[model samples]
Each structure stands twice: as structure tokens, then as C-alpha cells.
Target: MDVNTRHVLIAGGGYVGMYAAFRLQKSLRKEIRRGEVTITVVEPRSYMTYQPFLPEAAAGNLEPRHVVVPLRRVLPDVQVITGRVVGIDHAEHTARIDPRDGAAYDVHYDELVVALGSVARTLPIPGLAERAIGFKQVEEAIQLRNHVLDRLDVAESTTNEETRRRALSFVFVGGGYAGVEALAELEDMARYACRYYRNFRAEDMRWVLVEAAGRILPEVGEDMGRYTVERLRKRHIDVKLNTMLESCVDGHVELSDGTRLDSDTIVWTAGVKANPVLAESDLPRDDKGRLPTEPDLRVVGAEHVWAAGDCAAVPDLTGPPNAVCSPSAQHAVRQAKVLGDNVARALKGRLLQNYEHKHVGSVASLGLHKGVAQVYGIKLRGWPAWFMHRTYHVSRMPTLNRKVRIVADWTLGLFFPREIVSLGSLQRPREEFERSALPRQFSPPASRSPELESAHAGGRPEQDGK
Candidate 1:
């Protein structure tokens, strides 16, 4: 609260927030030592997830812990607060925060950095929220792995043909990199897992990918996308293009093309929208509900306020006029550094630079050894593309510790097969213990609810009472 000291409060601990804090701390190390400036980062999570490695983690290619960088460890000089920013009054230069375990409080800041990233852009489809899983966080990726492996276990143990069929059927919506990589990696894992089951064969399992768009992996160009579709089809995986998921009620998937299938697993990775926290603040936002920023990442029409990452609509100076940077890690990482340097420059009363980066390319991993990439206009596929995908992500992943761990996982994977163990109970660790503690007579009735009954019976509820 000293008059000479400046408090810089960052609203998120995502890619942009973390990197900006890192840059600011490094750039203003002298000021920080002199007690002239302080940096505080407020976010819900203690760690920043490297989302590109999520699919591989889910498929047991990398450990879950290695995919996340602890903010405190990474930003030792900066104050890391595990909390959510509920409201921000830029006019007053005050931010209201709700700490994870404490009461809400307001903190005044000389400068504000809005870097709260995006959230899953979901729809109002019946049973979608309850049944379908997303592929965003480390937890979701881990849960999907367990759920998929558990489904295979259920199919192997069950004699009912319909039940087995449903358990073996996996449906993924969306054709973006997230959806494609997740589906491909998981399918590969499941296929390898079949070797352990005497009754289950890779052929018996169904992998269905439904995309509302005309093609999948649009970032890799039309030819590569078409090739991806062909490769998937060759593996007997159902690739439905120009298709929409009508409903997923009770795991009964209905497509726009009038096809119905029973699937136990539904992974949704359609799209993402800017974090809704922007609306709570008095910041100027664009039509897409994103904070509008100048070429230099400073908030348009606001003083001492800057924005970047998926939450900010940063103009793409390297692209055509009126164009904006795409919401990808490539842009986010670059934008963060520029945004940080600009903040430091503003503090020192120096000139600011604009954020301008040309579109490099995109890479998508399909299964273990299959991938597609279009880097700097050069196209690649198969093993070369897959190697590029891993190398690119590992290099970008924060910290050398995490990089080494992930590389170690891959190295070990080469010697041993992918582990297909299902640890679904980790999602609800206390469930069995709580149930066991209950007296036999006082136990909940088996017929009380279909969901409870299914849990007790270790089977899914029958459709229409079968």
C-alpha cells in the first residue's frame, strides 16, 4: 500500500497470466528488489495445465502430474493467490476476490491484467452435461481414460450382447484438434487394451467421430483433413462429417442424419468461449464477449488495463486488416511475452510494441504414430508429423522438469505397453467407504433410484426397463 510501490494484479494464472508475471518479474527485478513494484496473480487453480498434452495423458502416454506446471513453483517471485476474481472495478482500481478457503476481499491495483482464458462452449442438448465428458483439464482427461478402460472391463464381464455393444461404442463430437487427438489416442489405447481381454477384440469396439463441420482438422488444410478421414475409415472407425448430435439422452446418441447408437462414452470438444469473468468487470469488451485490445495488447479505451490470451480479442497485425489472432497456444504464448514487456514498458514510461505474429502452422496427433502438420506451409504426415507434434509441445511446455518427466514417460512407454488400468473410483474416492460405513438395515433401498441401483449392481440402467 506504499505510495511508491505499484501493485500489479493479474486476473488469471493461465498461459498469458503466468508468462506475463514471469516477464514482468524478470524485467522489473530491480524495482521488485527496491520495493517499487509488486506482482500478484489470482486464479482458481494452483497449476497451469499444458492442454496440448491432455490426449496423450488420457491414453497413458504421459503422467497427469507432468502435464501441469505449479504456478507457485514457476513464479516464485510473484504472489500466487489461489482464488477467483469475482468482480473488478477498473474505475476504482479495485478487484474483489473470493479465495478458495477464505472470505472475499478487495485488493487495489495500479495496473490490471485480464488474462482469464476460455471455457468449454457447450450446448443445450439433453443429457449432454450429465453424460458427456469434456477434454480440457487434467482431471477430465484422466477421468476419460478411466471411463474408457472401465467400459472395456464392463463389456468383457457382461454376457448381454446389447450391453456389451453399448459399452464398446465410443462417440466423440467435434472435429477440432482437441476432439481428433483425444479420440485417436483413446482409440489406440483401447485397441491395445483389447489384447488382455479374451472376449473383446479391437474389431468389436466401435469408434465414432461426429463433426458438424464439412471436414476435420481444418488447420491442416483440406488435403490433410481428407487424408485423416480416409485413414480413420480404413481402421473401420466411423467418420461422420456434416453431422450434428441431435441428442445424447441416457447415452442413446441420435445424430442429425437419423442414425441412433447406444454409447456409454461421449466426449465433447466442440469449441470454447472467453471466460465469463470479463462480463463481471467494467472492462470494454467486443461482441464476442472478449476484452478488445490494441495491437500492443493494451485494453482499448481503458488506462492501466491490458488483456491477452483467449480472453482478449488481439488484432492480428501479421494477418489481413481487421483480422484477429486465433485462440491457440501458439498465439497465446507469443502474446503473453509481448503483453508482459508492454506492461513493463508502461511502468517505466517507455514506448510499447505491438503484438504481431504470423500464423506458423498446426499439428494434430492421431494415435501413437500417426499425425498431421502444416508448419510454415510445409505439410507432413504419419511418423514425422507425430514426432513434430511431441517435440513442439514438449518444448513449449513450461519448465524443464515437466519436459524431462514427459520425455521419460515416452521413453518408458517404448519399452512397456500402455497401461489400461481403470481407476474410475478415484473420481469419488469416499463413495465405497461411505457406503460400507452404513448399517445393513439402514442402507439405501436398491430400488430407490435407477442411478443408485446401477451403481450398486455394477451395470448400467436398462433402457425402457428392457
Candidate 2:
């Protein structure tokens, strides 16, 4: 180990952690070649999931593999640890690394980057955890896709009306970008999938979206939001506004508006809070459990520490005082670039630039050729918004390889019909292995077994031989 060398430790590999590492690795290439600085990224998953494309992936519009950026492939120069940074002790300049296997150990670092990201902000509604699926990662998206298709199968096969009705009913909680896009795309896919079913029609299936707020997708203007609601309603999709999910006990969904329905699928996408592991440290955090960062992406009053993305509350310079950046992918990718540059500047003893970016508006897709967007104060709906949504995300997606692959997927979708098969077994990849690992049960010789059985049954062992 070089005594003069500096180690940069990152706590995640999502938008912020991955892109920040890329920037630092590229900017500090010379320092890294000379072994003067080392960058290590600790993340539970080895790949970074491009969340915006998850809805499409779930709808079979894009391959799931293309939606994730392999951290090792993208950041070859940086040390990628496939584990988690469970604890951070900035006082000693050390972080506790809990690897995928073995015991947790501490790793020393000269600089620390907290880009741990966020987790689903869920409520304590009855049976929520047991029934609801969250659409945060690629696996969850894949699982949800399979689950929905499997529900259709159950509906077609079931003899009882109640059972079939429950199987056909799909409920999505929270009307934010995730819930809305996921529900719409999946519904479109499922509706089209009905072409193969013998007994079910798309109209027979009930798709419901429950939102607690007055409007959904507050990211765009109220008009665009209402228009989105109208589009969904026109599709015969139930869009419940100003309604709360009171309870979902045993698949019975009870709403605040006194509406009740039985649904097998319940997706939770209400919101996300900062990663909870940030609270384990003595580091300063805001009320929302996020690191309060300066305009330069530095953790407030914390030495050699920088934070960004959903995990950090970076002050929004373009907004009024006390306003922090939103936890959107747009902000996160931009923040990572600036944060990485500032980190490099700090290490090289140069002037650090403050991280600042104005909100560039938002875009969301409803279904294929259907969307709503407000970019630069100009509004778009239907196909244009859908195209813009895809264009922006593909351009923002990290690495040229992934960008090309995603585009290729889109090209394929144009020529081929959407895939409707469900691979739910992908969720339990280890099930087959576990079944194989079971101890073998071999029968002893018949005479030997019979002697033991006869003895236990009050007959002599010699009698069995006779």
C-alpha cells in the first residue's frame, strides 16, 4: 500500500454511485495508473438498473438484461464490491463492508461518497407487505410481469366466478411515474396477451389505479395530469383520485372512498425515502434521513465526505431557499457528474464547483404510443410524449453498449409482436437447485427392512428370514 495514495469509497452503484465512479475514474486515470488513488464502489447488486425502462421491460417491450448497466463492465478501472456498505464511521475514515458472503469487515478510505440511493416508502396498511409488489429493480419488474400474466392464466382456468374475478382484477397503489407507467404498460401487454386466451377478453379484466393525492404525476402540470387521467379512463381503466388504500387484507382491497375489490396483484410505488443505512452513522442528516449536502455536493460539515442522488438532500440553487433537488433520475445523473468532478477537484487540490441544475421538466408514458410530457414549459401528449420519453431516457442511459442494445430492442419491437409469455420461475432460480440438494432416500434390502419392521411389530428377526 502506498502511503501517499488516496482511496475513494462509494456506497452504491445506482445512477449516482455508478456515474460518479465513472467520472472520477476517467478524470483521475493518471493518478489511478500510478496507484496514487483507488476508487471502490460497494453495492448489493453488481449492475445498476435503469429504472425508467423498467416499465417497458415489464411489458416485454425491452429485454430485462439491457435495462441494467453492469458495474464491472462500465467501471473496469474501479474496484467493484458486490456487497453493501452497512455502516460508515467517518470519524476513523473507515466504512464497514458487508460482502455477499463471509463476515463484515472494515475498509479504510481517504474519501467517502454516499450515493446509497432510496428504498420504497411504504405505509403500514394491513397486508400491504404480504400482498404488494414493488417495481424498483429489474427482478421486481420481471416478477410483476410474470405475476400479472400468471394471474390471467389463473383467471382462465378457474371454475368459480369469485376466483376468476379476483384473478382478473389488478390493483396499483400510488399514481406516481412508476405506478402509472407500470400499470399502463402492463395493462396494455396483458390486454394484448388476451388474444391467446380462450376464455378471457381484455375488457373482462379490471385494472385499477388508486392515488391518495388530488392528482397523479405532479411532476407535470395539472392539465397534463388530468389529461393522463382522461386517457386512462377512456381505456376503461379505473383511475381513482383523492382516494386512499385503506386496507388490502387477504387480497380484499378496501379503499377510502368505500370501494372494495378483490385483486391478486397489488403494486406499491407510492414513493421512496433515502436509504435507511445512512442513519446508522454519526453523519449529519436531514429530517428525511438524507445527508444534507452543500451546493458543491459536500455533506454539510462532514470532512472528506460527499453525497448526492436520493440519499443526499442537495440544495436546489434554482429554486427558492431551503428547496432541495428532487429524487428523479434526471437530477441524479446530473448530480453524479458534478459530484464526481468536485470529488476529483478536491483530491487534486483544485477549486470545487457547486452542483446546480434547473428542473428540465418531466415525461411519462401511459401505454404504447401514449404519454404526457412537459419539457421546457411546452406540453405534449400521446405519441409525441411517448417518443420523447424514450428518446430522453435512451440518451441518458449509461454507456454506448447499453444505449445500442436498448435501441436495438426498440427496433425489434417495431417488427415483431410483443412477447406475452411469463417466466415467473425466474424469480425462484434456486428452487431447482434446492430440490436437487435434498438428501437421497434409498430403501435398504427387503429382508433387512422386513426384519427390522417385524421386530418393531413384536415378531422375531429370525421369523422374517424364515
Candidate 3:
């Protein structure tokens, strides 16, 4: 079977896959026009979400729609199928795709790109599965915002102090970028929301961060991490270092430090592991289950298969001596650009470029008006760091249109207040009204007017002896 005769199938549609497909579409425009090569992308979602701004999206800084790039619109030349790639039969040069609606498929791919990304790493701790929310997707961010506000609403109206305390207490497990940023943003938002609540006060709410390690933000160095801890503590946030979550059952959280707390919300952003799909493939994976890749971003042994991003253990040539690339948006995005370009080059029989990027210092959001940053070994704290955090991420947010939208959101946020309105009705669609009306219809006949019945039933009424 001639390899170039078949299509190139990319899996995941995340940072690497989407960008790779875009570069391929651009590089192979003439080939695609002449029907020489075809590109097919298999992903569970139709859109590729930029994850860095998810914290702000959760805090209502950026609109939800502006954070993601539609795969179909970005790569129209490529066949975008909403499906899960089950496995890679590298020996047969085929992939098994499981479509949500219909039968599974065996797609023959002359070239394959494994960019399935990563999943939130979790432990076998009791009740964590039920009690914790992850910080991965846009939906999770939005859901978190809604859940927090709902908890505030409960606390404001409840008379029981215990229940109110539990409603207002939020425990976050993990001290990484996600946990820190989310806690900071939510704390800011909650503090702002307190002005609107008659009974609920910002001091009444508790924000706690639990980390197993001695320090947080490993990327930001030990000194900066300590600075962050101090800043958070100044705001009265309980930053419990060297602590672990033993269990969280029935809203009661047990910590390794022999402390217990009953909280309604628990967010888990401790770590991430390579997608479970990697186990189904024949590619060479490291002990941690990430696909082993060369510096050039090609799979270790396979000729046609390439990988990058969090799912692949990329060699960090620019690391302190030697280390693997940290699973971060910076590495992922830069690696994706390289991976895309390499794929385009490989297709055109050109030399591929090696992936070697120096580590830029880290920036973290402390809250609304505070932050910490370390760039080129110069540490910055307070509003300067906070502004830098937002500025850098917004600049990297993909596409000029989205950049403009995000800037507009930030500009409006300065003058206008945060939109804390909870449209919980949005979650139920039209079913809430239908539910209330349906129960009323089951009441006495006189209670149900003819107009109401006609309106709800589309101009029809229940059959009866008139």
C-alpha cells in the first residue's frame, strides 16, 4: 500500500492536533487542491479551547465563547469528525475511531499524529471522585462560577450557621497554577459579590489551599512560591503547605494534618497524566505513560507518527542540565507550533526542526489587585505582576478577533461591575417553566385556563368529555 495515497489522520484536536492541521492545510493547499493528500481530524469536541484564560472565564473576565477556536472554521480543508480515537494499529497503519452517533470506523492513515493531550491526575482517596471538580475545560470553569455563586446564595438566606459556613467555605486541593489562579479569582469575585448580599460578608467565607508539597508553583521557583504563599496569607486565605487531602465525604474534608472542615466546594488541580488513550497504542511510552518523543517531536520508533504537548514526554534541551518539559500551556503551545511545522516539512520531504525552548519566568494571579511574577530572575509583586499576568495571557490568546474581544471584556470590567447575575434557568433550558406549569395542570381543572393549556400544549388540550 502506497503511504501517500491515503489520508493523514490527527487525533485529539487539542493544542498540537488543531495547530498541526492548520499548518498542514496551509502547506498542502496545492496538494489538497490537486487531491494528492487528505487530512482528517478525530476529536471528541468540535472546538479547541485555549486553557490559560479559563480562570478569568470562570471569574467572568472573558466571555466563554471567545476562549475557544472552532476546529471546523479554522481548518475547513480538513475533515473534522467528532469522535474518539480508540487505538492506533501502527502495524496496520490504521486508527479505530468511535463515533458518538453511529458505528466505529477503521481509518487508514498514511501518516498519524498522536496529540490526545492529558487528563487530570487523581489519587484513590475516598470521596474525591464525588466531591472534587477539575480545572481543565471551559464547562468546568463556568460550572465552578455558577456553583460558587449558588453557594453564596444559600449562605445569604440560611439561618443555620453550620450550613452557612459550609456553603461559604471553599477548599481547593493543589497549589499549581490552576489552583492558585482559581482561588485568587474566586476570592476576588466573592469579595466583590459580598457588597450585593445583605447578610453574607466576605470575611464569613473561607478560602483554603492544601498542597502535599512543601512549596507551590514549582515552575516559579521556591522563592517566588514562598512570596505567593505570603501574599495569599496576607489576604487571610488558609495556605496549608505540606498537607494532603485524606478524604472528603458528605462535605467533610479530612486533611493529613489532622484537621477537618466541612465545605461545599472542592477543586482538584494537583496534576495531570497523559490521556488513557496512550495505553491503547503501540507507541513507546515512558514510565509515567507519556509517549516518548525525539527532540524533533517524532514518535521514538514510528516513522509516520508524531507527537507533542502534555501527552508526549518532550526532551527539554534547554532545561537546567537535563529535564523533561513541564506540562504547561507555554510548552504545549510552542511545541504545537513546532510540531505543526515539522509535520508540514515531513510531508514536503524537508528537514524537521528540533524543539528546544528556554524557560521563561512564571506569573500568577494573586487576586483582583495583586499578583507575583518572576521574569529573567527579577521578582515582581503586587499590581504590576497582576497586570503582567493578564497582559501576557491575553496576548497569547490566539487570533486577533479573540484578542480584541478579551481586551474589550477587560476594558469594560474596569468601568462596569462584575456580572454576578445567576441565570440558573440557562442550565434547565425551558424545562423549569414547563415543570412548574405541568404540576399546576395536574391540579383542579378550573386552575388550568384554556389559554394556558393551548399555549403549553401547542394549541391542544387533554381529551375530556365536554
Candidate 4:
């Protein structure tokens, strides 16, 4: 790389980072080919995962691989580094990065874009750390599928009613889009699986939603949120609003509302907090630990440093002074485009434009052919909303190839039933193999008494008196 070349370093490879990098590569193609500008992306993962399709991945509607876009393949000209950017020295114009498996190095950059995404926010409640599972990653989706199946197997094999009841009860905490959609999709899958087993029935299992707030799906407003609660209740799901999980010790879940329920699985999906890396930087930040950026998306105090996505608190022009953009993909994806354009403009000494966008409503899938959506002040429910949810996200999914594959999955679903095979034993495959390899230790080896052996050889057994 030449000293005269404009070097841009993007801190993340998520929805914002990856998309922004792609735009940068395309916009600066001639400049990069002539050694006028260079782009480097530093992220822990090499692929960008589209999180909107995660619920369908959990429900077995779409393959997990289709949701991730490979950064190298998409941005052929840009340099993609698999590492973690730990800190930044803005005054020195250097970024501290810890490579995937090596020592730290200082990457010199003319401009920086901080797109580090948020992490799952957790509470300090007892037993939550050990008992609760999160729905953030693709791994969690796979694990939850196995767990649900494992519970089904336990319920199918056991004769103890108490054990069976506890095994069948599933509790989900938080009522946000993630929490509600995950619970709804998984419940739909589990209910469909009961037909294969003799002892299991849809009514036998309990699906409970525990939210600290009085309503669910706050994005859809009060009326629709209430409607969602009522619809779920009609399906025999126990919706406990304004209830907190006091404890979930070893399979027993106790609530603040005096209801004690025993369950095998607990999922936590309250909300998310920005990644903690922002605190180490010299850049200005808001009260919520988010980088303070100008309306043009440049970091306020740092030269050539820009921030967007969940890590940056971009001002909401449509809202009050204290309000910032909500940390969602809708904002991140759009803001990233503007951020990338401004980055290129900064290199050429052009004027940067301010980023002002209004909230485009939200949509969420709630199981098969069921959903809730609010877009441009219009509210929709049932199949129409679900169709809109799928259509909108599918359009936004990474590439055309992935969009085709996802649509194919939905098209196939119309003709065929879902595959609900619970591979719970997958988590403990080693234990299963060990049990098969080793002999039982509780009983002695088989042996033959002389009299029994003789009787088997056609001789009569001898009496003690004889």
C-alpha cells in the first residue's frame, strides 16, 4: 500500500460493516485500482449474518448457511482481516487490533468506521446465568432445536407425570421481537411433532411467556400488543405480563407474581446493549455508552472517524433532542450506506451530507402464516401481516442467491410439512457412545452352577436329602 492512498478501516463486519464495505469497494473502484484508496475490514467473523431470518432458521424453514454472506466473496477488492479491534488511538491515527490467533498490531488508517454491534443484555436474577439460553447466535438456534427435541423425548419415554409435566413446560423471558418470535416458532414446531408419539399431545405441553412489561411487541403499539397477548392465550399459552423471573434454580422457575413452575428450558431475550469496546476509545460518547456522531455520521470529536449502527448514537432528526435512533437493523443498514458515501467524500475533500431518516415501521413473524406488522402507520395481522413480514425481509436479505434460496424454502413449506426431528441426543453423543462401549458395572458377570449346568446337559437336579 502507498502512503498517498486513502486507507479506510471498518471496525465490524456485521450488517453495517459488511454492507458499508461493499458500497465503498464499488464506489471507489477506480481509485483503489490506481492505488488512490484502500479498504480494510476488521471483524471476528468473516461472514455477515442476516439476523431477520433467524426465527425461520430456528423453525427449520431455512438453512442457516443461507443467512450468512461471505465478506471476501462479496468485496473482492477490499482487504478483510479476521481479528478483533481492541482500541483506537485517534490522535496517533492508529487502531489496535488483536488478530484471530496472534499478537496485537497497530493498523494505520486515514479514516475509521466503528460499527461494532450490540450484545445480549442480561439481568442479575438468580439461576439465570446457568439456566437461561439466549437467541442471539446461529449456534443458539441449533441448540434450542436440540433442547426442544430432547424434552420431547423425555416426555415420550417417562411414566412419571410430574417429571413429564416439568419436561414439557417451556418458558421464554422478554417480549421483544426476538423473544416473542422465537417462542412462537418453536412452540409451533413442538406442537406439530406430538403427532408421531403416542403419549404426547399439544395440550400436554405448556408454553409460557413471561414479560416484565405489561405488553408484548411494543413496536406495534398498545392495541396490537394486547391483541397478540389474547391470540396467544387462545392457543393455551400462559402470558404473564408484569412478572419477573425471581429464580430458575435447577429446573424450578419461580416468578415474582407467586407462581412457581418447573420447566426444562428457559430462553432469555430481553434486549441488547452496545458492545463494550466503545469505552476504550478517545471519541465522544452518549450516556448509553454509544459513540456520539454528527448528523453526517462522523464521530463528533475525532477527525476522519465515523460511527454508525448499534455502537453509535446517531441523532433522530424526527424526534426530540434527547432521542437517538433505535438500535435496529433497519436504521443500521440505511445509515451504513450514508456513512460509506461520506467516508469516500471525506477522502476527496467533498462536503458530507447529514443523515436524517424517519422510522419505517416493524414486522415480525409469529409461527406459520401468523404475524404482526406496522409499516408507514398501517397495522396488519394474521396471514397478510405474516406474508408482508416474509416479503419485506426476504427482499432485504444479503444477496440475490440467498434471497432465491429463502424464497424456495417458503415455497417448499407450502407443499410439505416441517421436519421436526429432535436431535437432542446430539449434545450428549459422547455419553451415548461411552455407554454403548462400556459394560454395566452394577451386576456380576454371568456364571453357571454345576447342578444347573448338568441339568441343561440332560441330567436331573440332585436333591439335598438324596
Residue runs of model 3 more than 4 Å from their true location after superposition: 1-6, 320-322, 430-434, 437-466
TM-score preference between candidates 2 and 4, better one: 2
Cα miss at 159, model 2 (Å)? Answer: 1.5
Local distance difference test, each candidate? 0.93, 0.94, 0.88, 0.88
Residues 1-466, model 2: lDDT tens digits: 6789999999999999999999999999999999999999999999999999999999999999999999999898999999999999989999999999999999999999999999999999999999999999999999999999999988889889999899999999999999999999999999899999987788899999999999999999999999999999998999999999989999999999999999999999999999999988989998899999989999999999999999999999999989999999999999999999999999999999988789989999988999999999999999999999999999999889999999999998889998888787877889999999999997666667766988877987784455
In model 2, the runs with Cα more than 4 Å from the true position are 429-466
Q: Write the per-residue lDDT of candidate 3 for residues 12-107, one digit (tens) a residue.
A: 898888888888888888888788889999999999898878888888888988899889988989999999999888999889999979999898
Q: Clashing pairs in model 4?
A: none
Indicate the worst ten consecutive residues by lDDT in candidate 2.
442-451
Clashing pairs in 1: none
Q: Tens digits of per-residue lDDT for model 1 on 186-254?
A: 999999999999887999999999999999999899999999999989888899999999899999999
* Candidate 4 lDDT trough over 10 residues, lowest sum: 440-449
Q: Order the candidates by lDDT, highest first.
A: 2, 1, 4, 3
Query: Candidate 1, which segments miss by more than 4 Å at Cα?
Result: 441-466
Per-residue CA lDDT of candidate 4, range 110-143, in tens? 8899999888888898889999999977778889
lDDT of 2: 0.94
**TM-score result, candidate 2:** 0.92
lDDT of 4: 0.88
Give me candidate 3's TM-score against the actual structure. 0.92
